[model samples]
Target: MRKIILSASVSLDGCFEGADGGLDWHLVDDELHTHFNDQLRGMSAFLMGRVNYELMARVWPDADADPSSSGPEAEFAGIWRETPKIVFSRTLDRAGPDATVMREVDPEAILELKRRPGGDMSIGGARLAARFRQHDLIDEYRVYVHPVILGRGRPLFEPSDDRKPLALAGTHTFGNGVVLLHYKSD
Candidate 1:
């Protein structure tokens, strides 16, 4: 079965965004950005919430405008264009090219996608990731923990009926104090 991985960059305080819903504070440095892009290279498709998808759809294409550009922004632009995206939203009617808007949280869809012969699927939004976790569908957890602490903001996991222990698979600390932690459901 294809794996479902949840990858996110979070603050040390366990928040995905700052108090103002601004991710500008959690900027990934050049080295970390390169590392993140390398990690994303293995994903066959992305499953994300409407909010995250909208934000990414708006920014990445603009970044891809110039092929001559170098760095994570450019790399992200190129790779994102090719990567398949499935946006889960009840309100969004349409998405840009390369994205499919999904209204239902169907387990059958996930099961079918997992059975297909392809690269791994990745869940990108905190809420979406939590739902997958609750459903016991996620195969792996990859958290890039940054040093800064955003006292309050969106959390990785909300109160839910499903809670499972996870075992650490590996961990690596970046020079900028960002720790990449990999885990599997225990």
Candidate 2:
């Protein structure tokens, strides 16, 4: 079965976003953007929350058309457009092509998707990832830790009473000050 990978970028202090809900602190330079494009290109699908999907849809869809967009940005635009996306939303009535809007996260249904023949799926959004973590559905985690410290903000992982063990699968430090920590559930 294909694995479910929860991929996200967090600060050194463990915050995913600042108190103002802005991700401007994320140091996604050309090298990191290209790395993201390369990594996400092989995914079977993206599972995300409505907020995450909408935020990406607003800019990525037309990014390639903009002349000012960098090579990596344009490449990522195409990759994002082609990839199948499943957005979890309570109020969303519909979604664009190659996308599905789910009212809730169903573990059985997600498991079925993983059983099918395909590459691994990537789950985005902290809240959605928390839900998947609650169900013990995530098989791997690709966390990119930035150099900054938010001090206070939304954390990458939600609070849980039970402790989960993860084995370090791999690690990479980019030219920028970001470090990728790949971990697999033990």
Candidate 3:
């Protein structure tokens, strides 16, 4: 079965965004962006929340068309456009091209997608990931930790009474001081 991967970037302090609720600190240089492109190129689908989907839709759709876009940026734009997207939102009536807008996270539907033959699906957005985490639906977790630390901000995981253990699968350190910690559900 295809797996559901929860992938995200966080600061050294484990904050997804700064106090101002922005991810401008993410060290996404060409190498890192290329790495992201390589990793995301094969993803069969992307599970996202409305906020994340809108954020991406604003920039990525025309990023390649922009003359100032870098090589990796253009490449990633293609990858993003090609991959199927499933946006979970009650407020959105439509989404970008190659996207399906769903009102909620349905386990059976997710399982059906997993059962289909293809590459694994990635889930982004803290809220969407939280819902999937609560359902114990994520098969893998890939967290890219940057070098900077924002003393306080939104974390990838919210406090929960439940404890979900994960096994370390692998780790990779980029030249830009970004570390990718891969884990599997335990």
Candidate 4:
């Protein structure tokens, strides 16, 4: 069965976004962006929250059309457009092509998807990842930790009553001040 990987760019302080709901601090330069493209290109599908899906749909769909788009940016645009996406939303009535809007996260349904013949799936959005964590569905975690401290912002992992241990799978540092820490559930 394909694995469910929860991928996110977080801060050194363990925050995903700032108080104003911005990720300007993320140091996603060419090296990191290319790494993202390489990592996501092989995924069978993306599982994301409505907010994250909408945010990506707004920019990535036509990002390559812009003359100013960099090589990595254009590459990611195509990858994002071609990849199948499953959006979890209660408010969204529909989604774009190659996308499905789910009313909620169904663990059995996700497991069924994993059982099918395909590459691993990537899960986005902190809240949605938390839900997957609650169900113990995530098989791996690919965290890109940037060199910044958002002292105040939404944390990557919300406070939980239970503790889940992870074993380090691998680590890589990019030219930019970002590090990819791959971990697997223990």
Count of residue pairs whose backbone atoms collide, per candidate: 0, 0, 0, 0
As for TM-score, the candidate ahead, 1 or 3, is 3
Minimum summed lDDT over a 10-residue window in model 3 is located at 104-113
Off by over 4 Å in 3: none
TM-score of 4: 0.98
Q: Output the lDDT of residue 30, model 1.
A: 80
Where model 1 places Cα greater than 4 Å from the true spot, the runs are 66-70
For residues 96-168, what per-residue lDDT tens digits would candidate 2 score against the true structure?
Answer: 8878999998999988999999899999999999999988999999999999998999998878896889999
- The deviation in Å at residue 178 for candidate 2 is 0.6
For model 2, how big is the CA root-mean-square deviation? 0.8
Candidate 4: clashing residue pairs, number: 0
Per-residue CA lDDT of model 4 for 1-186, tens digit only, reads 999999899989899899899999889888788888999999999999999999999999989999999999999999999999999999999999889999987889988998999999999999999999999999999999999889999998999997899999999988887888999998
lDDT value for candidate 4?
Answer: 0.93
Best by lDDT: 2
Question: Residue by residue across 1-186, what tens digits does model 3's lDDT show?
Answer: 999998899999889888899999999999999988888899999999999999998999879999999999999889888999999999999987699999988888888889999999999999999998878899999999999979999998888998988999999999999999999998
The C-alpha RMSD in Å for every predicted model, in order, reads 1.8, 0.8, 0.9, 0.8
Cα lDDT, model 4, residue 178:
86
TM-score of each: 0.93, 0.98, 0.97, 0.98
Number of clashes in model 1?
Answer: 0
> What's the true lDDT of residue 15 in model 1?
87
